[model samples]
Every structure is written in C-alpha cells, then in structure tokens.
Target chain A: EPEVTQTPSHQVTQMGQEVILRCVPISNHLYFYWYRQILGQKVEFLVSFYNNEISEKSEIFDDQFSVERPDGSNFTLKIRSTKLEDSAMYFCASSRRTGSPLHFGNGTRLTVT
Target chain B: AQTVTQSQPEMSVQEAETVTLSCTYDTSESDYYLFWYKQPPSRQMILVIRQEAYKQQNATENRFSVNFQKAAKSFSLKISDSQLGDAAMYFCALSTGANSKLTFGKGITLSVRP
Candidate 1:
C-alpha cells in the first residue's frame, strides 16, 4: 500500500534558523495534514491542506509557520525561526477525501537547540 | 472545542488475555468520527480501528473492536487475545465533519507479558 513518507527522520536545527520539514504524501490522496507530538504529550494538529491551499489550521500554526505543496507530490512545512519549544515529532498524513481516515507517515523528529 | 481524554496512562495484560482501553470525548458537533491509533516503540503511528458516530453498530477489525456510546460520548477499544505486538502507546482521537484535523488524547501505553 502507498504510504506518506517524510525526509530526514531526525532533524537538529539551531534556534532562530529556518527549517523545512518535507513530506511526500501518498499518491492519489487529495487531503494533506501536519501534526506534531511533543514527548509524552498528545498529538496536536498544525495544518491541513487541500486543493493546493490551506483548508484549516490550528492556533499552533502561527505566522512563523507556513505550508506549501510546491509540487504535485511534495508537501513541506517551513518554520522561519525555530524555537526550542518547536522540538517534537512531526507527522504528515493524507486521505483520499473528506471524512476519510488519514494515513500517517513515520514522522520526523525535530530538535531545536 | 473538541477534546479527547484517555484517563488511563498505562495498562498491562498477559499474552492471550483481553484488554480494554477507555476513551471519552466532548464535541458539540453531531457528526464526528473516532479512531484508535497505536504507536509502538518504533514510534510509527498506525491506525487500529475507526468508529463513525452515525453507525449504531460498533466497528470491529479482526481482534480489535470498539464499544462506542454516542450518547455518553464514550469510545473504548478492546483488544481480544492480545499478543506481544499489541504492546504500544494507544491514542484515541476525534475529528468532526466540519474540521478534519484530529484532536488526540494523551495516549495510554499498553504492555503485554508473555
């Protein structure tokens, strides 16, 4: 089965530096999303994209955060200035349509120093 | 706001025994979906089962089943004949039709004894 794949399973970035987390959502899936889980915490939604634009976003998705499809397959989340609090495991997910269950990637562990 | 709650932080069951993990959610929207996701030590999130709010019958997949009480806003997962592979952090999540973003509860760690 096709699965969402994320690059650089582990990323370590200096504070105040820009970092882009890349993901290749499952082919043929229409909806894409980004979620993050801090250690020992619940997973939190960051953003959701559809039709090449953001459909919805959480308060955690601030001005410093941005998402782009960039291409037909690549969905990337860019943090302009990383903060130490940004450290977490980021998961990329995709679904065939609205109301469909999302399939998640193996997640990228980001550590901001 | 939609919130999912997993009261139990951890649970353990002997191999071949049964285990149930409890989850409760508060949502104003009538149309929503509940899901169970398992994250093993590898930390890969895997979908275990899903229950649609509109469905009266509980959702079941092989040894995994859900006891969904829409009125009580409760959804629980039951793993029958548990195996070592069932050891993982199980998360209960909720998503509404208006918003597809999932709100997950603090996951419960499940351990299986041989």
Candidate 2:
C-alpha cells in the first residue's frame, strides 16, 4: 500500500540551531499533517495543511514552526530555532480527505542537545 | 475540547489468548471516527482498525476488533488469538469527521507472552 515517507530518520542538533524535516506524502493524498510526541507523552497535533496552505495549528505550533508543500509530492517542516525541549519524535501523515484515516511515516527522531 | 484516554499503561497476554485495551473519549460532536493504531519498536504507526460513530455494527479486521459504545463515549480494542508480533504500543484516536485532525491518547503497551 502507498505510505507517507519521511527523510532523515534521526537527527541531532545543538540548541539554537535549525533543522528541516522532510516528508513525501502519498501521491494522491489531499490533506497533510505534522504531529509530535515527546518521550512518554501523548501525540500532539502541530499543524494541518490542505489546499497548499495551513488549515489549523495548535499552540505548540508557534512562530518557530512552519510547514511547506515545496512541491507536489514533498512536504517539509522547518524549525527556525531549536531548544532542548524540542527533542521528540516527529511524524508526518497524509489522508485522502480531511479527518479520514491518516497513514503515518516511520517518524523522524529529533534530538537537541 | 476532545480528549482520548487509554486507561491501562501496560498489559500482557498469552500468545494464543485474548486481550482487551480500554479507550474513552470526550467529544461534543455527534458524528466522528475512532481509530486504533499500533507502533512497534521501529515506531512506525500502523492502522489496526477503525470505527465510525454513526455505525452501530462493530468493526472487525482479522483477529482485531472494536467494541464501540457511542452513548458512553468508549471504544475498546480486543485482540483474539494474539501472536508474538502483537507486542507494541497501541494508541486510540478520535476525529470529528472525515478530513479532520486526530486527537490521540497516551497509548498502552501490550506484551504477548510465549
């Protein structure tokens, strides 16, 4: 079955640095999302993208977080400045329609020192 | 606000026996969707099963099935004839409608005993 694919399975960065996480959603999917899970915590919604723009975002998805559909198949999340608390597993997901079953990527583990 | 809760943090069952994971959600919307997802050591989230709020019939996929109680706002997952490969962290999620964002529970870890 088609699936969401994320690049850089694991990343390590220093505090105040920048990091870019990339994802290639299912080719036919129309809605895309970015979520994060801190160790031993529940998954938190970051942002949702549709029609090539952001639909909704949570407070955790603040000014530092930005998502872009750079191309027809590539969706990317960029963090302007990283902090120690930014360490977590970031998952990219896509669905044929909004709120439908979302297929998730293996996740990119971001570790900030 | 909508919240999904997985009451049990961990559970164990024999390889061939059955096990149930509990989940409860609070949502004001009448129509929504419930989902069960599994994450193994690789941490790849995989869809195990799904249930639509409007449907009364329970959803079953292979040995994985759901006990959905719409009135009580509870959705539980039952794994029958469990296999060793069933060991993983299970998350319960709720979505208000088609094409909506999902709210996930903290997840429960399940271990299948030999």
Candidate 3:
C-alpha cells in the first residue's frame, strides 16, 4: 500500500530561524493536508491543498506559515520564523479526493528552541 | 464548527477482555464522517475504523467495532478480546462533506495488561 512519507523525523531549530517540513503524499492522491499536535493537545488542522492551491486553512496557519507543492510530488510547509509554541508533531496527510479517508505520514517532530 | 470529545483520558483492560472508548461529537452538518485513529508508542497514526453519519448500521472491522448513535451524537469504539498490542492512544475525529480537514479530540490512552 502506498503511504505518505515525511522527511526529517525530528527537527530542532532556533526560535527565529526558518524551517521547512517536507512530505511526499501518496502518488495517486489529489488532496493534501497538514495538521499539528502539540503535546497533550488535540490534533489541529493547519491547511489543505488541492488543484495546486490552498483550499482551506485554520487560524493557526498564519503569516509565518506557508505551503507549496514545489514539484508535482513534494508538498512542503515553510515557517518563516519559528516560535516555541510552534513545537509539535506535524503530520502530512493525503486522500484520493474530498470525503475519502486521509492517509497520514509518520509525522515530523519539530522542536523550536 | 465541529468538535469531537473523548471524555475518558485513559482506560485499562486485561488481555482477552473487552474495553470501550467513548467519544461524542457536535456538528450542525447532517452529512459528515467519523473516524477512530490509533497511535501506538511509535506515534504512528493508524486508522482503526470509520462510520458514516447517514448509515444506520454500525461499522466493524474484525475485533474493532463501533456503537454509533446518530441521534445522541455518540460514536464509541469497542475492542473485543483485547491484546497487549491494543494498547495505544485512540483519537476520535470528524470531517464534514466535501471538506476532508479532520477535527480531532484529545484522544484516550488505552492500556492492555497481560
């Protein structure tokens, strides 16, 4: 079974530094999403992309956050300036289409120091 | 806005026994989907089961089953013949039609004793 893959399972960066989280969604999937889980908190939606544009986003996805499908295969989330609160497990997910169950990646643990 | 709630923070069950994790959700949309995801110590999120709001029958997959009460807005996961491997953090999530962005609950940690 094809699954979503994320690189740099663990990332540690300075508070003011820029960081990019990479994800390779399932080859055949059309919808891509990013979610984050702060320790002891519920998983929160960050953004969703389809047809090469952002479809929906949450408040947590602010000016510092941006997502792009740089190529046909890789989806990347870039944070311009990291903050302590940005530390969490970031998950990448993909679905065949809307209403389909999303398949998630193992997640990238981002630690903002 | 949709919200999923997992009231029990943790639960314990002996091997071969049964355990149920409760979840309730509030959603104004009549058309939506519910899902249970399991995260073991490795922290990999695994899909356990899914329930469609329009379906009257509950969803089941082998030892995993759901008691879905649409009227009560409740969706609970029942694990039968539990094994130590079943120990994990289970999350209840919801997504509305045409919008696959999932809204998840805090999650419940299940511990299966041998």
Interface RMSD of each: 1.3, 1.7, 1.1
Lowest-sum lDDT 10-residue window in model 1 chain B: B94-103
Residue pairs of candidate 2 with colliding backbone atoms: A98-B98, A98-B99, A98-B100, A99-B99, A99-B100, A100-B99
What would the TM-scores of all predictions be? 0.98, 0.98, 0.98
Best by lDDT: 3
- Which regions of candidate 3 fall more than 4 Å away from where they truly are? none
lDDT of 2: 0.93
Candidate 3, residues A25-80, lDDT tens digits: the string is 99999999999999777788999999999999999999999999998999999999
Off by over 4 Å in 1: none
DockQ values, each candidate: 0.74, 0.74, 0.78
Place model 3 in a CAPRI quality band.
Answer: medium
DockQ computed for model 3 against the true two-chain complex using alpha carbons: 0.78
Task: Please give, for residues B62-105, the per-residue lDDT of candidate 1 as tens digits.
Answer: 99999999999999999999999999999999988644778899
Best by DockQ: 3
lDDT of 1 by residue, A77-99 (tens): 99999999999999999988767
* Docking quality tier of model 2: medium
Candidate 2's C-alpha runs over 4 A off are B97-99
